[model samples]
Target: MLRTQIIKLTRAPIRSFSAAAVRTAEGDTGGVRSGGVASSDSFNKREAASENKFIREREMETLRQLKEKLRAQRKHLDELDAHISDLESTKGGEQN
Candidate 1:
């Protein structure tokens, strides 16, 4: 799962790079171009946007997993507390 996400995450940059390269080759700058290559500014902007989206998605996934773990732990802690209370009550009864 994580490996797949990482693969996808890493692929975005390459995909964007190749797309930009093709666009540059075709002279589709949509604006000014220098040295026969698309402006780095636009490319960088797109890359940064994609990266930010990926990071936000990844962080949300991590937070979801953490929340699930915390819920399970809380449930287990509640069960343990009940068991301890039962044991204490039984001990008190036996002494009476």
Candidate 2:
């Protein structure tokens, strides 16, 4: 019962190669291979495209984060430079 539920939840709605195997086992195809070779090819292409899209989105997010970090660091460096210059000018005035 639990196994059946898992199968129902995990399986795609479309009939797949496993269904074809089951049909063959039940003599639906009389132990002969059907002409759905193109279906598997299309399925593989779709899966690959999905994985590629996922990777691309992750890479774009990582790039956006890095850009934000770089912008922050640049701002901090500029602030530090301004503070150092202010300190130097004050010390020069005191010595004069």
**TM-score for each prediction?**
0.58, 0.60
Q: With candidate 1 superimposed using the best TM-score fit, by how many Å does residue 84's alpha carbon deviate from the native?
A: 0.6
Error of 1 at 12 (Å): 42
Please report, in order, the local distance difference test score of every candidate based on alpha carbons. Answer: 0.83, 0.83
State in Å the error of residue 1, model 2: 34
Q: Estimate, for each residue in 35-56, the C-alpha lDDT of model 1 and write its tens digit.
A: 5445677776898899999999
Which 10 consecutive positions of candidate 1 have the poorest summed lDDT? 14-23
**5-42, model 2: which lDDT tens digit per residue?**
99899987875666445333452424323557686667
For candidate 1, report its TM-score: 0.58
- Candidate 2, pairs of clashing residues: none
